[model samples]
Each structure stands twice: as C-alpha cells, then as structure tokens.
Target: MESLNKNQLALLTCVIALSFSETAQASATALSPSSPGTPYSQLSNKVMAISNERIDKQLNQEINKVNDVMATRVLAKIGDFSSY
Candidate 1:
C-alpha cells in the first residue's frame, strides 16, 4: 500500500508537471506570456488544488482500511470473553 501510494504520487506529479509545461508552451507560442494571476495560471492552480484533495481522500481511505483490518484481527485473537 505504501508503495502504491508512492507510485501514485509520482505519477500524479509527473502528469501535472507535463500538463503545466504543455500549457505554458502553448501559451507562449499562441499568445502573450502569462502573468502570475492569468486565467491559465488560475486554472493550473485549481487543478493542483483539486488533485491534492483527491490524494488526501485516497490516503484517508487507505488508513481506514488498515485500521479496520487491525481491529478485526485483534478481536479474533481476543475471542469472546463477554460470555464469561
């Protein structure tokens, strides 16, 4: 799971970087250089923010799964002592 998360982070970073690069190149060639607050930059920022939120959700889900597994195994080992 850790490895999977690392791979996902790497892939996401690469994809976003590539997309930003492509957008920058396209803008440079097709129009004036983009300023800091331009629509293109704003769009890129929004994409990054959204991706970050998604990553956080994925990590939280993974954590919950691990917690559930641990709880189940602990209960199995402890057995039912309530009857005593």
Candidate 2:
C-alpha cells in the first residue's frame, strides 16, 4: 500500500509540473508584443498613418493662412500700383 501511494504521489507531482509549465508559456506569449503581421499591429499602423495625414493637412492650412496674411501686407505696402 505504501508503494502504491508513492507512485500516485509521483504521478500527481508530474501532472502539477506540466500544468505550471503550460500556464507559464501561455502567459509569456500573451505578454509579448504582437508580431508585425498580426491584426493588432496592422491596426496600429493604420491609426498612425491617419494621424500623420491629419497633421500634414493642419500644417498646410496654417501655412496657407500665413501666406495669405503676408500677401495682403505686401499689397497694402505697394499702395496704388494701378495708377503707375
């Protein structure tokens, strides 16, 4: 009976070890960053691309506004060139 108990204990210990190893592996994979080909990475790239495009558009608008102001000032300084 003692030998049988010993065998059962050993088997239980092995099962527990295997389960812990599997759990650790699963958690490690979950915590790791997603590969570039993954959907999550693709989505992030798309979001960044959109954000950059928006920034470019806003910069262009501001540049245009400044140009318009400068042009108006230059025209005012020229005074009635039409008479010349």
Candidate 3:
C-alpha cells in the first residue's frame, strides 16, 4: 500500500510538471517583444504563481493522505488490536 501510494504520488507529480511546463511555454511565447515592459521570452508571473499553487496543493493532498494513514494506525493501537 505504501509503494502504491508512492507510485501514485510520483505519477501525479510528473503530470503536473508536464502540464505546467506546457502552460509556461505557451504563456512565454504569447508575450510580444514590443509589448511595453514585458520581454518576449519572459514567463508570466501568473504562470509561476499558478504553478506554485498547484505544487503546494499536491503536497498538501499527499500530506493529508499520509496523516490519514497515521491516524488510522494510531486509532487501531488505541482501541482493540483484535478487531484489526
């Protein structure tokens, strides 16, 4: 079960990284060379902000799953082992 959880988390990380890269590339290209203070090759701050938000969200989700498993084990220990 722990290995499965690790695999799932790894897969999720890969997917998120892939998608964020694509989005950042697209946004970078969308900005024009002559567009005011913006550089053409520069990535948008919004893209970075969103990517950070996604990473934090994923981390929090994984952390919650781990916490849940710990809580279940703690409960089992506190209660009856015969039931487990």
- Model 1 alpha-carbon miss at residue 79, Å: 1.4
lDDT of 2 by residue, 1-84 (tens): 587467656755655565555555554554467644567665556555554555555556655765687689779768767558
Per-residue CA lDDT of model 1 for 1-84, tens digit only, reads: 687578667766765665566556554544455554467766667556655665566657656775787799779767866555
Q: What local lDDT does model 3 show for residue 61?
A: 75
Clashing pairs in 2: none
lDDT of each: 0.63, 0.59, 0.70
Off by over 4 Å in 2: 1-38, 80-84
Estimate, for each residue in 1-84, the C-alpha lDDT of model 3 and write its tens digit.
788688777867776876677667756655646566865345467666666776677667767776888799889887887677
Flag clash pairs in model 1: none
Candidate 2, poorest ten consecutive residues by summed lDDT: 22-31
At residue 38, candidate 1 shows an lDDT of 61
Best by TM-score: 3
Candidate 1: where is the Cα deviation over 4 Å? Answer: 1-38, 80-84
The candidate with the higher TM-score, 2 or 3, is 3
What is candidate 2's TM-score against the reference? 0.47
Per-residue error (Å), model 2, residue 21 = 43
Candidate numbers, best lDDT first, in rank order = 3, 1, 2
